[model samples]
Target chain A: MTAHPLHVPPGPVDLDAIATDATPGYGGSKSDGKAALEGLGPELADLQERLFAEGRATGSRRRVLLVLQGMDTSGKGGTLRHTVGLVDPQGVRISSFKAPTADELAHDFLWRIRRAVPAPGYLGVFDRSHYEDVLIARVNELAAPEEIERRYDAINEFERELVEDGTVVLKCLLHISKDEQRERLLARLDNPEKYWKYEPGDIDARARWDDYRAAYELALERTNTAHAPWHVVPSDRKWFRNLAVGTLLLDALRGLDLGWPAADFDVDAERARLLASEAST
Target chain B: MTAHPLHVPPGPVDLDAIATDATPGYGGSKSDGKAALEGLGPELADLQERLFAEGRATGSRRRVLLVLQGMDTSGKGGTLRHTVGLVDPQGVRISSFKAPTADELAHDFLWRIRRAVPAPGYLGVFDRSHYEDVLIARVNELAAPEEIERRYDAINEFERELVEDGTVVLKCLLHISKDEQRERLLARLDNPEKYWKYEPGDIDARARWDDYRAAYELALERTNTAHAPWHVVPSDRKWFRNLAVGTLLLDALRGLDLGWPAADFDVDAERARLLASEAST
Candidate 1:
């Protein structure tokens, strides 16, 4: 019997939904995200227990890759910090990709990223991912028009390969408005404590805000494959973003159907016997 | 008034304690380690909070370095994992030094390590540290006699400088008996799940344990200075090792009288106002 490979659709993301101007009020009052997260928390806790137990019992673990891509100041770090809080460190890994090394830039765009994938039974969080090709590379005019075209195809194929091999790909694009970004940037500048978060370069990026939005739209349209659909999250509301992202992560992890390996012994019975032995001794 | 620095010591480490057989029953009973950790938790938590709050408020966060050196089966990772749990991530950092990379080896021994120093108001944990000059460099016969001498002097001076500049340096040497190590090694080999943790090369190292001991003894004798004292922990008991190490770290952090930076405004009082604004809107 021949094995069936996973299939992916090549389609552009519906940009209208992503860029919707509905002033749904930041972190909606109705609490859909919160309600969803409450349901997801126990599932995440269970998954974490199973994952760690299996890792220790079997000595083999599955790896998870959570890729986050978004506009500047889109709370990527915040999301990462919160997401990891749910899982065990023994089975989790995080890598934040900043500027590529000279060696990294010399190779194909995906080369450096592919090397950082987590081993099985582990979770790897990518702050910015291969989509850098479609974001920073486009914004800074670092690559030629044709190079960008090649990269989009390469990323799709690369993600497909990871998913086919039991790697779960969960990607999020944090959505925030230009005005909201301006306010946040101002807040960073106004607060002496947050001054470290701001850079003069950020202002230059802000000036090209329209360009970034158009670039993001194109990226979502061109690279949002079925195996890895981009979740456009409304992130003006911090609590809502956390709730939404946390719920999505919990759901994705639960869907993997992770379970503890069969025990080497009946732990309860053995534990009781060990306790009795100690008592007698 | 003539400005003068504090009467600082030659090195941060306490050399006197290094050579002593500090732990009589290391690896003997795991319960001892658990008790030590229990006593340390609150102290560590308090210090971590103070340091993190100071860092966030003042932005002049001091750096802390805890260096762990041990034999193959000793509990460096366990010590670090437990210690890190006591501190906030925003206020702590950990780096496990593996064998030198080609780029690392090309520079001075401390080049790679120096970069791993935590930012201000942060704790940096080194799984193993520059003591490799005396430990592995001596064991593996990597450095020339003169070069090794220079490193020891350099390490002493470097650590002294860090302490003078407000970096706290705490070093621990986890000491386990040969018989205890052998049993732990055997357990690793016997447990199929833990087999991966055992390397055939460890057996080779076990054979040369005497040489490693000599190197460690020499490291303690020469490099342990007044500012940094090497706490030789009994690690035959993994739980006890964790506890002793945690206690040591908590003590170091608590010794530093960290407090909140002078607030320009009453932020907590303002919190209610901010929430009210959100509610009114």
Candidate 2:
């Protein structure tokens, strides 16, 4: 399998260096990209089933965690509907984090996140995950500067623990330009069908676009590790974004090298039992 | 828009009366039925989104709970993969109930069931559900006969509470014959790929099929109410079963009469704000 080309390299990061509309490894037209994404369904489903089977039969602890972070209208929900929808929903656990509740605020930030981790053999998706602690928390001054600085290390340690325990943490920063966000927001405002998605607070966030961008750049730079790397997915084109994330997931599942679990019971004995039961019926 | 013919009416239910292979309301070929199920997808998705938007915008508590109860090898998992897989996973919450833990057993049976109910606007599916308390427990005499008798009333009241609270409870018993189950078990035994799904205890349960069927009949007769009806879906043909359940879900959604949520904010103001933001960018 070809290596994903969107991986964020370790160094001082510049968000503007990559174009939000560029379809990095894919050279296909929009229609072709969609077809390619649909083509990934069978293989992704098979691999996911094998992984699930391994966990049930052999008690394998291996799992996958796909964390999606993006600006408003950067398409986290779309990625879930299009890319993650390709696999069996039984084998996937999706948790979307919202603003911290009073109970959540009382506990450590990771408290809610820890509870939502997927069980063995499940693909866990975090939409706007713990990274929000550093992103929004930083931009809005929700925490003290020292405490905000400390969360970066805390997140790294928490993710490293997950990786060491056999979780393949694949993080994607859905990169979109301010112009694209403005256009998407305007589209939502223009269509009554999309009105429910538009929030007044979205404009407030857009107003602090440069601040959020700097926060994201720092978050990506500090947390990008060998065990769990961050991929910057260009998101201006919804089709390419969906296709890239699907391909990345397929690659991760393929890396598991999963196979059909061996039967624990005697096959011949089970066969005889079935036949006798059939005869009796 | 046709009424589902598989619904178990308020009178006595004979498990043997309903043919396990009959497609009562549908008269299409297997391929045609499959196509028909696929055709329900777009409408299902649209209605689900409307329901979701309504919940988000207006705080509507209306939700759908699909309870799937069936014998082992009766295609509950297959139905989930094919039928429930139609809608966006974000809008669907699926919980598979297994043997209760010590924590769960300490409380009432409905304790865990209550915890897994879907939030407002979400479509919740139970792979196996509270019905198990009646079916497996009564078949095995796990509870006292008097206690078991009282649970029928308890379940009815419980479902009534859910229904009155704006939940549409749609229960389906995936009905299959003993011969069909034997064939399915045999097929599992013959295929190593299906080994993970086969359990030694499944044969144990198969040995007491008649008792389990009797228990099911009693449970359905007692708990079947005007508010929460039970549908006996024939599971001999996988395609028909998928289509039946998908159609039932679509009907339920359409019955909700969901419309696109009206915008809460001033549309023109947000539009102007977006344009101004674009100008600033």
Candidate 3:
């Protein structure tokens, strides 16, 4: 089969443009994020029920890959919680990849990740993803320069392949200001309940904020394709960030228009027979 | 807090008794498993909605760990898929633990599992869990005899603590006869799509069926506390297995009587502010 050239968008879409067009500015609108969610809750509920029901009936297990990449304290976890909250659990699966195992690094970086992708008719949310090749690997100077460049190309091709074959790829970079991150880190240290989530490595990383930002910008420039465009959400206001990110995912999934596909009656007939066998003495 | 003693059911309420009473030739009703789940689909849907909504409002996550430990080809995965189908994706999370990570082995076995438990007011399902300590470890002789004994005591304490703190632990051992397992394994070999799920190791274990059964029986005996009883499900019939396991979880979670612990709403004042905000916009 011939591989299709990826349809990456021209130049990264401006974060400012996304903020203005997609989401109402934080604290500027009559309905805040919480209120908006409260208002949308019931409708979203019905939508989820219908989507999952249709998905199962048609057996159209369309795979969705939600790749979340962000700066420190950019609310990746929060967005994951909210966005996943809006979908059907049965039709979704999440895989959070941490530092690689020895076996993982021994092979291609994509080896472990490819195994984790959602099967058809499901959503797979990645807490941090293959972008680490560009982000952390670059930031730490871990990859030889040439290998790093190759990964960017492979990722573009990989995403294109998945999208072409019915996987929906939605990538997000939750962008928070350096100042806001410092404040959040301090708060995490202060709050005992959140203490377990913090590590000393986080403080070391915070010290290199500018380097990380540059890496992220380069990653975005190279990888933002039409099939999987990156949404640089201004997460200075988490409430606004949640609303914007939630809207993006809710829209993309709805865009799929995955009404139930036709199923042969044989399985249904067999299922009835199976159930009947149980009922009969 | 003083750790409580393990709470076993008095006399005949344990899995052994249940198994004996449930055996078809032992004069128990044939369809007890199927009958238990008669109205479960709707009930589970309703439970999932309430569970997710509670997670949102309270931000206190709870977990539903569905520990499915059974004999080879005892329909564990099928039961999991069928049951999760009835749950809302938002409030539920499922983790399938395979081989241990290096980090997992470095700590107590339960350490990795504890991290995966749902935050608060959420449901977490484990297809196979730390019980593998007794099952696979015993089967493979992976641990020293002393360590194996220590783990059972540790698991009992671990489960008791989770129950005390509000995690609803529902454990199911899908019990299928030796003859039935051979049938399912043959079916897996017969189907192309199911080939990936079949491992050759399964057949070797099938060869040692009695050893595995002894291991499972010991596991159920040591850890079946009132808070987390072991439900020895008759899984010879895959459909009935799914229904029984799903209904068991539904019954346990529904028994919790979970509702939105009253939100502190300043009703009149908030209504006025809401109206005024709408007017100003």
Candidate 4:
């Protein structure tokens, strides 16, 4: 219920103003942060199960959507592996958006995203979500400037509809420095195990870092809503990033005030039926 | 690859003949088995990443399909939580099939099953699969006797096509006894946290335990092939069940002989470009 320290406040957004290595709310060594994340498993799992139960038993539409956006190698994949991995996979619905296909391009940008929305009682995660329409689409001049302007309003309205329909949208921008990204890209090229992650086009994107940052600043400012606030996650330190995101998710779930759904069937009757059936067997 | 001890051999599979509490391959205490499963994390994660990388880099059709079929509360969901949870969720596509809708029923049973198959380089998991058509349909006469008879061959052919097209189907029958089912169902009833899982219909299914067992025995025998053999996992103990399924998945991934996919681009040239870009910035 309290304000999250990492929540991007309403203002003119500046990517350069925030330090990427700052562990804003958490004060711990890497091991301490890791252990804290591990400790959160039980509570997070229980709350998630309760949410899942509420949806199934009562057909409640309440759900959570975690939208992750960042530059290449900003640890979207790592966030999924460590932080999001804490909950039961069955309760999570993850969709990674790549370049749109022919069919996707033919329709509105939100067309594909709508199809991937989490069903009732799911923790939906979008890695490189519809934000791409404004980010990459803006940086590359893939769409007209006026059209790009229109999309910001379109996205805000779409997200508002989701919130009204019992969805909690948690948007996180995995903020990292250019220096950190350079190091990570080099490391990927250095290690054979990580080589599969490196693509030449990543350099092309990196070259336009300033343009991407400007694009992000505009997008974050234009689309930042009270209902679906964006959190700028400082992701230079992997451990802290995971801890922050995990805490953010934990807080969002706690806000829901989820509890075990009450039994719909008569407990005594079910018990009697079970015993009678056992005896007959 | 060495033969897995829990694999059902080519012959009649007597559900009564197999002891439900037996932990055939695991030689450890509950904590030890849990630790052993945990020990598999790094290796399992690496292999899964490689499988995912191969799919992305080369457009390789090689994939895995882990089909889990069992009575309710047979630890299918547990296996997913503890075992499949070890892998990167990005690479794992899980589909849990419930009762078919009017649209689903209008088509062949395999039609829905086919739509949920894993894409290239994915670890696909089905909580309950097409085998349900034979199991439940046969038990309740949901289909005509002749139609149920025809589905056995249809399933075999469908699976064979998946295998031939580069899917390694790992079918697991989570074997548990009638007594075990009663205890599990009772546990669900007693615990408020688990009450959501206790449907009254589960008792009805338990009442016809013998018929369900017979259905499983025949289904396993008819569909078991060299390419996709059934592993009868003794799932009475939750810890051992998690370990056995983890080991099965690890062995299946190891059998793929996966490695870091070769870089599709010139690494040195990209590295040079990266450094040059950094200098410009």
Q: Which stretches of candidate 1 lie over 4 Å from their true place?
A: A1-10, A14-63, A71-74, A86-93, A97-123, A129-169, A175-213, A226-229, A233-281, B1-61, B88-93, B99-122, B140-147, B157-167, B237-240, B251-281
Off by over 4 Å in 4: A1-5, A279-281, B1-5, B279-281
Best by TM-score: 2
Q: lDDT scores for all predictions?
A: 0.66, 0.89, 0.65, 0.88
lDDT of 3 at B124: 79
Compute the lDDT of residue A149 as modeled in candidate 4: 93
Complex DockQ per candidate: 0.07, 0.66, 0.07, 0.60
Our model 3 lands, by Cα RMSD against the true structure, at 11.9
lDDT of 2 by residue, A1-281 (tens): 22243988898789999889998877778989888889998999999999988877877899999999999999999999998898888888888899999999999999999999998888999999999999999999999999889998999999999998889999999999888898899889989999999999999999999999999999999999988899999999998899889989999999999999999899899888777763433
Task: Report clash pairs, candidate 4.
Answer: none
How does the DockQ of candidate 3 come out? 0.07
- The C-alpha RMSD in Å for every predicted model, in order, reads 9.5, 1.7, 11.9, 2.2
How well is each residue in B30-147 modelled by candidate 2, as lDDT tens digits? 8898888999999999999998888778878999999999999998988988877998888888888989999999999899999999889888999999888888999998888998
* Model 2 chain A: worst 10 consecutive residues (lDDT sum): A272-281
Error of 3 at A192 (Å): 32
Instruction: Give me the runs in candidate 2 sitting further than 4 Å from their true place.
Output: A1-5, A278-281, B1-5, B278-281
Provide the clash count, candidate 1. 23
* Model 1, position A78: C-alpha lDDT score: 70
- Candidate 4: how close is chain B to the reference, as a TM-score? 0.96
On the 0 to 100 scale, the lDDT of residue B255 in model 4 is: 95
**Chain A superposition TM-score per model:** 0.82, 0.96, 0.83, 0.97
lDDT tens per residue, model 3, A1-281: 11111223567543333331234434445345667655554554445444554444444556667888787677887776665665445456776677888899998988988988876656678889999878889889988999999998899999988888778898878777665766676665555434434555665576666678678767888888777777676677776777766666666667776443333334344333333332211
